[model samples]
Target: MRPYNFSAGPAVLPESVLRTAQQDMLDYNGTGFSVMEMSHRSDMFHSILYHAEQDLRQLLAIPSNYKVLFLQGGASAHFTQIALNFANGFKRIDSVVTGNWSGIAHSQMGKLSDVKVHLAAHGGDLYHYNDLPPASQWDISPDSAFVHYVINETVHGLQYRDIPQLGKDAPPVICDMSSEILSRRINVADFGVIYAGAQKNVGPSGATIVIIREDLLGRCSERVPNVWNYQKHIEKDGMYNTPATYPIYMAGLVFRWLQTQGGVAQMEKINTLKAQTLYDAIDGSGGFYRNPIQPQARSYMNVIFTTGDKTLDERFIEQAAVRGLMFLRGYPVLGGMRASIYNAMPLAGVEALVAFMAGFQRRYG
Candidate 1:
């Protein structure tokens, strides 16, 4: 049996998707060439791209007004690209710093000399990165170009259970959903832009998915190069440059797999159960295991916890690896254990981890 992988990105993929890719590695659909070797301009690849978008639209119920662009450069690259494109003609942008990724994005936007970066809200101030502050307390500037926030923080394992409801006159809301995209249902029309790195729930590391409202497309600054401009890529149907062809194709297959599993709604239900199973195990362990984040803010995708004993935590990780529960070590900045249960992870995998946790506690606790 294959060990259940729990690494955060370039993470675990569905067994069936891997099997399909394995079968197509040499020749995809009898095209006499691997998807890796095919021309991006060819009709076969175009068909793959078209179906991928359509399937994703169906899954998310994405509005017609939103243009989905599959582009190169990880979501991190877009931190500056977003400012170049949207922060034009404005003095400042509001950024809510809830965790590491948002903090990085906030800092990246500050690098642009033209626009000032405003801290709209920060969770670390009061919650110490354990929970989010109430949205009502966000210090949003009325004239800011856009409001930036992260829907989920992968490292800190904090997730926003409720969407922020900025008033009608507020600036556009741009979100980084790298860790939790496609894991649940979201109102596509709620934000002006949403971007995610495909490594987690989507497909792989090379492809970045940006869903931008049509009206926001024209906001790119003239000084911005074609490569960094959202409008330029959208004008060419996201083919301005030779895109990440194989990663896009892999993402297309993942979309089809999501459809077969009854789309995001059903996946959300399963994800909820999987997360609850693990969280419950942690909570029920008395003082043996503990998760610091507030229950409401805990991520359904990444569960972070610890025994409060460094030696025990290390021993748990070591023994769990032997039991096929791999990559259970937490982020270095936050030393503990993290079980990232993306959509591709089966409930059985999480159950296996929980069982191991119970056995470990029994042996050591």
Candidate 2:
């Protein structure tokens, strides 16, 4: 049997999606060529791409004014592309430096263009990564092009329970929702741009799904590369060049699977139960297994915990692997243990992890 995977991105996908892909591997739609070998410009591919976009829009309740573009380069590439597209005419871009991903975006924006990047509200040592500062602490510029934040940080186990409220005349809010998208319901109208690498909750690593407000298009500077221009991609129907065809098809299958499971609202409920089951295991351990993140800020998607003893942490990971749990090691920066429970991770997986933690604590604590 395949082990339960818990890696951060390029993470688990629904079993049903995998089975469908396997069945269609050789001949897709009675066509002689496999989906991997088919010409992207063919009518079959167009139908695949069209239905994928439509299903995603319906799943997310994406506004008619928004444009969904599936592209390459993942979320990291968009860090530079975002500045190129949105930061041209504006004087500054405000960013919240909460964790690794958002911090990376903030730093890259400063180097990518002429826009004066503002570190709106950085969490200091006292509250770093484990908690989010109050919205009142943000030093947002009224004239900035946009305010950026990550909805969830996979490494540090931090998540924003609600969208941060900006000032009355605050600039548009841009989010890098790489790890959290599709795991729950969200207001698509609340942000100017929502981008996520299609790895964790969506599909595989090749495609980056971007949903941008219509008004945000056509704002790319002339100096911006054609490949990175959002307006150009929109004009070309997300097919300006060869897209990540297989990954897009895979994402479409996953979207259809999510629809069968009652969409994101049902996903949110299952995700909550899965996260709470693991969190309860940690909390009930009586300081044996501890998660540093505050209760409210803890991420439902990525759970990071510690054994208080480094050797015990190491031993737990090693032993868990022997029993079939995989990739339970924490990120090097966090230095303990992490379990990334994306939408594809079922409650049974979380239950198994919790049971292993309990048994390990009994043996080692």
Candidate 3:
């Protein structure tokens, strides 16, 4: 039996996608070879990548003007790539610091150029996430590379419900939608660049998916290495270096599975229902438990809440783990429990988690 996996990521994949891959593992489409053993340049592999990119573009409704490249860097590598592409002629960037990941992004860019790490509105816990910096306070530059924000901060269980419209005063908007990409519907046209590491929401960890506006790629600073540059990957059709063939293949399968599930819009509806079930349980669990973000900014992907008593929280996780609820613990940077309900987590999975939480709360409330 599969346990309800709430791992932040490298998390859960749809069983159907996995099953299909398993079926095709040994003999891919009667080609007499495993997909794993196929050459990346083979016609079969080309078809896989071609369809994967097609599915992704359809899922996100990405425009033809944007280039979608499946690169090798994790989001961490993107920390430098973003700065590399934009900071060549530009000197500064505007970023919002919500949690550790964004904080690291802010700091990493600091090494390359003058990154103006704008202070954001952060409340103490999950209940206070909506406190955002006023639009008026956003330091904007007409020529600044881009403004970065995580639509969903996986660690803090914080989400920006609406993209902050900085009017025409700010630089182009760039987003890291790693943990929540396909879980909900996003206006792809709203962003200048959108990137995600495939592990969490896509399929596996090693591959990073970058969607960039075509015109922005060639402007990188001369100091930027060719391999790390977005234009290089774009020009090479993301095969510049040896790609993660297996993960990319799995991602393609998963993308096809997503198409069967009615794409991102349909998935968004199911996700909303799943998140609400879990959040409602936490909210109604009484003063015994507390969430850290404000109501409006609560993340549908990662639900972070704390049991007032640390010892009891530990016990709750321990008991839940034995019951087959796994990876419900918080990140080391944040000392609390987090339930990451990504796209793969079905409505039943969230329901199971809520049932477990209620039973746990009843015993220890």
lDDT of each prediction vs. the true structure? 0.92, 0.90, 0.81
What order do candidates take by lDDT, descending? 1, 2, 3
Off by over 4 Å in 1: none
Please report the TM-score between candidate 2 and the true structure: 0.98
Alpha carbon lDDT at 238, candidate 3:
79
lDDT of 2 at 92: 91
For residues 1-365, write the lDDT of model 3, one tens digit per residue.
89989999889999999998889889999998897898888888888888889999999889999999888879888887888786666766777767767777877875755555443433333224445444465666766778887777888788877767777666788889898888878888788899899988899888889998877776765566778878777777777887888888999988888889998989989988988888888889876778867788789999998897878888989998999999999988776899888889888888888888888878877
CA RMSD (A), model 3: 2.2
Quote model 1's TM-score.
0.99
Error of 2 at 308 (Å): 1.7
lDDT of 2 by residue, 1-365 (tens): 77889888789998989999998999897996789998899999999999999999999999899999999999999887898998888889988888888888888986768788888888644496679876788888778999988989888899988777775788888999999999888999888999999999999999999999988786776687788899888889988999999999999999999999999999999999999999999999999999988899999999999998889899999999998899999999778999999999988888889999989988988
RMSD of each: 0.8, 1.1, 2.2
For candidate 1, give the lDDT of residue 71: 91
lDDT of 2 at 171: 89
Clashing pairs in 1: none
